[model samples]
Target: MVIRLAIVFVLTFVSCQEENDIAAKNILGIGRMQAVAVSGRLICNGRPATNVKLKLYENEILFDRLMEESRTDSNGQFRVSGSKREISRIDPKLNIYHKCNYNGLCYKKFTIKIPKDYINNGREADRTYDIGTLNLANQYPGQSTDCIN
Candidate 1:
């Protein structure tokens, strides 16, 4: 009877440990669900484009979901955040509405690709991506211009 009790106790202890492990993992996952920050600067006509509207969209097949929106500061800096899962999928893009002129005409709208590498793949506890400088005056020369409207 003592041997049987010892065996049962061992099994109970092991089961409890497993349950605790799973619970800990779930807690960690919940903690990671916080927003991932994205930051960058916008330069137009060789100067900071202040108050430019910037929007984050999750590119989807049927419809695009707007995740966050921000306006450039006086220094042309902006910061936005979204869930890591949403921002890391299907090639996220940034839509900028500004009056950046090109060839005597103001290109009022533009889109820029946010590289997948800029998003954390759920491997880091804290994630923030800096997309560097985006120049509205020039759309990187021969890049896809269809995003301009």
Candidate 2:
């Protein structure tokens, strides 16, 4: 009985400590609004890759939060902007979904990280990260396959 009581006490203490840590993070600006924006062009085999899906996201600890989503225009250009309230500096990234070279059922996925300097502390981003033209035919370093964006 005494050992069981000790175990219960230890578990309670650990849980309370975790809660305190969360509270401390909140107090340190966990929910302040931040924003970011990105724009770029997509090309495949020297031609415009039109109608390609793109998404902007705030990378979180457990799950990523989508900020904005759009598709490439007929000219293969796209722009995405998003804002979120976060505990720390928002980790912004752009996810591109396309079928550049693969004939598989799933689309090719690529991620481009926006530098921390571009993360603005406001409802709207002050500046946009220009990701110049990216040739999708050339395999990227950390590319993956995704059926869902």
Regions more than 4 Å wrong, model 2: 1-30
Cα lDDT of model 1 by residue, 71-107, tens digit: 9999999987654333224356777777677443443
Clashes of each: 0, 2
Local distance difference test, candidate 1: 0.65
Tens digit of lDDT per residue, candidate 2, span 1-149? Answer: 99999999877755554346446556885578789999989999999999999989988765677789999999899989998776678899999999998899999998999999999988899999999999999989799999876
Runs with alpha carbons beyond 4 Å of true place in candidate 1: 1-35, 84-90, 102-107, 121-125, 140-149
Candidate 2 colliding pairs:
30-86, 30-87
Task: Quote each prediction's TM-score.
Answer: 0.57, 0.79
Clashes of 2: 2
Lowest summed lDDT across 10 adjacent residues in model 2 is found at: 13-22
How far in Å is the alpha carbon of 115 misplaced in model 1? 2.6
Please report how far candidate 1 places residue 72 from its true position, in Å: 0.1
TM-score of 2: 0.79
Residue 53 in candidate 1 has what lDDT?
80
